[model samples]
Target: MEIREDDLTGQQIIALLREHLENMHEITPPGSVHALDLERLRSREITFWTAWEGDDLLGCGALKELDPTSGEIKSMRTPAAHRRRGIASKLLEHIIEVARQRGYTHLYLETGAFPAFAPARALYQRYGFEYRGPFGDYADDPNSTFMVKTLVG
Candidate 1:
């Protein structure tokens, strides 16, 4: 599988992002859904990437610079057909590596607190992320689970 920076111009990427938005809305409460829309993902602060196998898109993830030394993981999605094949894991690894390369001292992400988000929480935990309280513009929200990983000593 190949993971590379994406400009989010492809139809496939757009569709996948749309699906991600839909899924987030379906699972999270109205005020708690934090998934970035296409416009938000394209912001200057965010770097987006997609995982591909030959011509097939496996998944996508993004790193959003919250400040010079920190970032927030966003828009991580692996289509249902590509689930359980380590696609999301690979994408997450790539995002973390890129964050380190960019001199980010830390990375944080907020995911749903629902059962549907268990697998994702597990994936982050496996990668050394620990549960944390809300950061950035986020406040206390029972529907969200915040996690963090230090990228620098």
Candidate 2:
């Protein structure tokens, strides 16, 4: 599969992000759901990417620059039909490499505390991210699981 920087204009990616938001809301509490919508993901601070197998869009993820020295992983999702294919893992690895290239000292992400999010939490853990308290603008929320990884040169 090939992963490319996406402009977020294609119908497949739009739908994928919509599904991601819907699923996040379905599983997480209202105030604790931190997934970004299409508009929010379009911010100048965010770089979005999509994984494709020729004509098929497999999944998508984004990296948002929180500051000069840190970044946040956002909107990581693989469609229901494409789960377990390592699409999420590839996108995550790409994002982390980009963060390292940009000189980011740390990479942070916030996912749900629910059982539905266990797979996601496991994925992050495998990448060396450790559970941490809230960072950036986040507050202490019982439904949120925050994680951070300090990048090495």
Q: Stretches of candidate 2 above 4 Å error?
A: none
lDDT of 2 by residue, 27-90 (tens): 7878998999899999999999999999999999999999999999999999889999889999
Q: How many residue pairs clash in each candidate?
A: 0, 0
| Per-residue accuracy of model 1 over 20-126 as CA lDDT, tens digit each | 99989988889999999999999999999999999899999999999999999999999999999999999999999999999999999999999999999999999
| TM-score, every prediction | 0.98, 0.98
Worst 10 residues of 2 by lDDT: 21-30
TM-score of 1: 0.98
lDDT of each: 0.95, 0.94
